[model samples]
Target: MKTVLFPVLISSALVLTACGGDDSPSKAPAPEVISQPTVAVKVAAAEPVSALERGEQIYKRCKACHTVNEGGRNRVGPNLWDIVGRDAAAVEDFAYSQAMEESGVVWTEENLSTYLLKPSAFVPGGRMAFAGLRDEYDRDAVIAYLKAQSPAAQ
Candidate 1:
């Protein structure tokens, strides 16, 4: 019993010493980090489109009704050639609402801006079917586009 017990005790101690020692396997070394160049990136700023160009895009919707070319005939809406600075509802053959014709408003940029924002609001009981350009930028663009076509622009 002593011989067997001695060997068993020795074996247990050896196992414990091996496993519990500070000589355990180490973790893998961290990868070497290299410094990179500090690059100063040049960011190009976006340039705004010319008002006339932007207005041209906005005018695509208005093309269905208004024409900006000189001598152009009225369609669903009146011919808009030289409309800027012209009197409102002054297209000769085109029928204008009493409300608009009697509004006594000129087609100045300021008036046009207000009118384009909400046509009906600008002239109550007017016959224009457009809901109006809601965006201030869009209204400006349309005005710019109209100005570009008008003799006043040149």
Candidate 2:
């Protein structure tokens, strides 16, 4: 019996030794992560609006008081037909301020630019209640619009 038990115990010990190491399951290695290169991006600039188109939009302010068409009736202000080259206060039957009537000036583009910048400063005691345009682009746009609307331009 002692001889048989000793052989059985030796065989069990050998079997346990063969199954050694950690009890947890074996795991595969994780995949390596690759980084991408950075890139530079450029944005395109927007197209600029034409002066005539911009002026037409700005002139909506004037539409309340004046008309730029031929034979268009005057409103709070006089009709502006041929206004770019016409004399100051030249609209017939439309009453003008004493300062404007006596200004004795032609409606040159430069003169118009100055006047539209500050109506009161251009002609003290004038009756135009419009606050002048501060932006040079706005003044230029409206001038282009008025010039384009003229019969002479056609």
Candidate 3:
């Protein structure tokens, strides 16, 4: 009895639902015209960073192992206070590998770039532990930063 009554109620609901909305082809609702709001945004041209500035920013990677300020203490790597013109593996308290000590490397801009490219390859067995910069511009910039940190620059 309950099933029969439910079917009758459902059929009536279906008939009423079918008769409700305007389904005429001529009276179909017009396609919605959605207009997105236009927002005006002003973009400023990016200021170009100087080579030294860029190098300084990049030097953050080395900060864990090195210090660039004058008389700064050494970490895993030596304090690079006057590294631009200094000998490799010359830091007093820092331990350097035999390969680096005997490599006879003088830290010129070009030499620094090469070493920074691949420290392990540059001085085989030297313990830099850095996976080289690989980018020439980045090497140049970091060298510029080192030069700026030197006493001669001041």
Top candidate by TM-score: 3
Better by TM-score, candidate 3 or 1: 3
What are the TM-scores, per candidate, against the unseen true structure?
Answer: 0.68, 0.71, 0.72
List candidate 3 segments past 4 Å from native: 1-42
Of candidate 3, the 10-residue stretch with the lowest lDDT total is 20-29
What overall lDDT goes with each candidate model?
0.88, 0.91, 0.91
Which pairs clash in model 3?
none
**lDDT of candidate 1 at residue 90, scale 0 to 100:** 89
**What is the per-residue lDDT of model 3 for residues 1-154, given as tens digits with 9 covering 90 to 100?**
9999999999999987766656665554678999999999999989999999999999999999999898899888899998988998888888889999999999998899999999999999899899999999999999999999987899
Ranking by TM-score: 3, 2, 1
- In candidate 1, which residue pairs clash? none
What are the per-residue Cα lDDT tens digits for candidate 1 across 43-144? 999897987889999899988988889899999889999998899888989998789889999999999999998888999999888898889988998888
**Number of backbone-clashing residue pairs for each candidate, in the order shown:** 0, 1, 0
